[model samples]
Target: MAQEELKSINFMGWRKTIGAISILLLLVSIVSLAVNGLRLGLDFTGGTQIEVGFAEPANLGEIRTLLVEQGLENPTAVYFGSETEVLIRTQGAMQDGALVLIGNRLEALEPGAQIVRVERPAAGQAGLSQVIVLDGVSAAQVRDTDIFDRTYFGNVEFAQVEDGLAVTLENSLDVAYTNRLLTALSEHANTDVELRRSEFVGPQIGEELRDEGGLGMLVALFLVMLYIAFRFQYKFALGAVAALIHDVILVLGFFSLFQLDFDLTVLAAVLAVIGYSLNDTIVVFDRIRENFRLVRRGSPKEVVNFSLTQTLERTLITSLTTLLVLVMLFLFGGELINNFATALIVGVLVGTYSSIYVSANTLLALHIDREDLIPPPKEGEEQEELVP
Candidate 1:
């Protein structure tokens, strides 16, 4: 059997405070953005890297010293649980030469240790500086460069090789080869390598991903707003949209302040968070709508407060259950899933706040009229009409 709806509380009682709470959440989000800039993962920033695991565990400092001697300058060497597995990052400047020096130096440092081959990534030929975000384009804006119709132009920066244009792509030239033996995906298909992979997407691809991903999110939000508006009133829908945007800004602020890698995967997680937060908001709004119908004596704020209290147990229970699973994934899912899990954890907490403190509070601020929500009686009171 369906669970009976809980009795409504006096919702409008502390609406002003609830609104303040919503504003506070938004404020926290703003502060996070300003201070903790999100860490952008290598996925978005273009760079070259090398990961070599030794059969016999070796010294990290010694290896780092060797890498520095190899002209890598300042190298970042991270140990993944043991001395044998190490992750190294090198600047894209002279990345190709650095890779060779690293291999040679490691051989010199550990004479007996087996030196594995280094893997290099494909360099992006295109850049985003040429691309411009435009408002309305008129016919006159079309220049000899094909400005209006064609907004994006791709130019590949080729690697200098002994033989010209060693690599090939349509309408794009190979990067000038510099000792860096770029990854040959065709050659390494299906076989799993010991070195776990981390990718640095070129600005071109990052821009594409960013543009397309952003568009998708905007469309999703627009559709959600449209649906909510149709179901309730325009003001109610606007409130929902406001709450959702608040959640998104807060999440972004956290990422920006911390300098989190804003990759496609991270973007995907943000979208999921928006939808999840909206779902929570809708649940609260649905309850509020029902209460407005059931009771006419109470003001909107009392109705909202009552509705929140009634739904409090259910909301917390759901949030806690999800949090429990996410915490497990976060603690044990390994490095690959850490960021994604962290995003979910933050989203869940923020979603809960927006639902209890944001969505309900929004309805009150809109001054949603119970008379508008509830149909006028046919010459009778609600209680009289309900009776047989």
Candidate 2:
């Protein structure tokens, strides 16, 4: 691939424009936090979630209303991940017994409301092909279950038993207390229940998670800087680190501002975004280094502009494709993926911007040079090809 010829762009002139966009996004993120507060999942804020399937399509409003009728005040009813199931969650649940009763009542009200079916029958891979089973029905009974199935990772709550689909009652919570409740529910409902999936992070656990996540991110940034500093220049590493931090702060601020659940998954996504941003920054840095070696007349800022302009089309294509996919997920993928999708959407936007502006700008501030970044060709390496 032919390298892009250096083309000086008025980067400094665009500073105000970029700053304005950043400020606007920052404010929008803050508002998203303040108003439509983050819909944290069970992984972050500890709570109980119950998923019950109806024979018919779940009417979210009706479900919540039905919950209210059963004395389940303020029970949040969102369509379960898959299957004809609806997930209801409550906080600091002092109403475990009631939910089972409610479950039965719903079954009675909506006779077709059976356990949500989300079983994939193995063809030859496991046993059969696409043998959809009930929440936990065996492969043999899958045909019986697949009469009406349309989703992956069938409706079985994670780790929940086949006797009955498990409900998330609390994340990082009191296991014994919850287990007793589960047993009582199993018997009361005359349903075999396993502790399928339960995410209960007590205040202590939540705090620990937050602390550890924060610490881990810092460690990652430090490590990335060290690695880059060795491979390139301290200035380049420092710039990359700055850009990475910008991505993280923006992601977290969006979460905090929205009071979104800062769960483990979200944490993982944030870390992944950092690496992603770094990868992009590294690409641009590589370009800048190569151009610096080939053209000795331009300043660092000029090299950066040329590098950015050269990669502009590729970056746009990649980011747009990713954003397009994420947008679809955000709109049609349902509530379970809402936050994950949301996090990705936010992270992608910020990561793209930081890769170009923040990362390169920081490098300029540090007065980076070709030798500091890409030392002259070593013995046999023949100047490892700079990324196209």
Candidate 3:
């Protein structure tokens, strides 16, 4: 009876129009991706990310100018959480060079301030033991400097050894790099700057992650196709895969078009989109299959329209509730997860549309019929059981 009421609305009647719109969006997305390409983030591209907090509000323009003057190429500085916090990103790993620069600047600050590097005992183990020798100045002078703050050096403890002030470093190059970067910023800014956090990704690792991520997406799609085929039919599988691909491409294209950072988080969101769209498509397909076997005296188009209308309310309710949470996350989640939330938001919307239009349209385009979904009667079984 519910199916009979829904049959009044010809959902499939707009297939041609929706198909044209989908094709147009797909073409635009493809061309934009081919031309502009995605803006790969620090995770997928080799780079250093440093977050620092200042005693007062930081001036991004001045900070960028200072970094540029220091010979750091293409340094990007933006507000992290508040006006007093700044996040900086730069291409390539500059730890070694930064350490050398910081050492030189330290010597220039105090005539006899020297940084001595002590080799660790184990050959296979990484990192070095560093000490500060105040030959011409007292420990008090060193403590008075802006660089003496404990927060400037991440994961390093400073203690007075018998010879000089010993600085034990942990986590290898990351600690050393953060110390150097913070020292440089403090020296230049001449203010109290605290190191919040630091991250460095090698170019080789970034390339590997990018490659592996793409391969993973492809594998997921292939497995989805196989699962749908085994669960339903080849026609349904083809349609489901088509919709998933459409959702993925459109999501990627959305990032490319806007030049948003495409990171591991965004990639994860795209995969989630595939799963969400697949579930929605499967639900609609399930109803269509059930209707194909139960409803008599209806064409394939009429059956599909009835199935879509029957599931429309469910689909909208699920999508809207999910979108509500996503929207809140986007608005209040902070800078660290803004892109992640944006990707999910866009994916959910596109996924919903593709499930409704692209997947259903593909089934109709393939000339799906009741005979394709209805299984043949077993040997010696009555033919009446197969009648719909």
Using lDDT as the measure, which candidate wins?
Answer: 3
Candidate 3 regions with alpha-carbon error over 4 angstroms: 1-6, 57-74, 77-85, 95-190, 380-388
Ranking by TM-score: 3, 2, 1
**Candidate scoring better on lDDT of 1 and 3:** 3
> Residue 68 CA error for candidate 2 (Å)?
6.7
Determine the backbone clash count of candidate 3: 0
For residues 1-388, could you state the per-residue lDDT of candidate 3 as single tens digits?
3434444467778989989999999999999999999989878888888889988887788888877765454677888879889998877666544455556667777876666654342354244344443333445655656444446444454566566665554444445556656777787778889978878889899999999999999999999999999999999999999999999999999999999888899988988898899999999999989988888778888888888888899999999999999999988876667888998898889988888788989999999998898786788577667677
Q: Tens digits of per-residue lDDT for model 2 on 10-65?
A: 66457557766766766776666577665555555555666555554546675565
Runs off by more than 4 Å, candidate 2: 1-5, 16-40, 65-75, 95-201, 258-261, 374-388
Write candidate 1's Cα lDDT for 1-388 as tens digits: 1123434554556657877776776787787766675555545444545564555664667656655654553445656656566576554433344334533543454443222322232466333222121222222322332211121123322233332222122221112112121222112222222445543446566567667887998999899999998897777798788888878887787777666656556777889899888988888888878888886676676667777887789889999999999999989775556778878888889888888767767766667877667554676676796798
* TM-score of each predicted structure versus truth: 0.62, 0.63, 0.73
- Worst ten-residue run, lDDT, model 1? 172-181
Candidate order (lDDT) = 3, 2, 1
lDDT of each: 0.61, 0.63, 0.79
Deviation from truth (RMSD, Å), model 3:
8.4
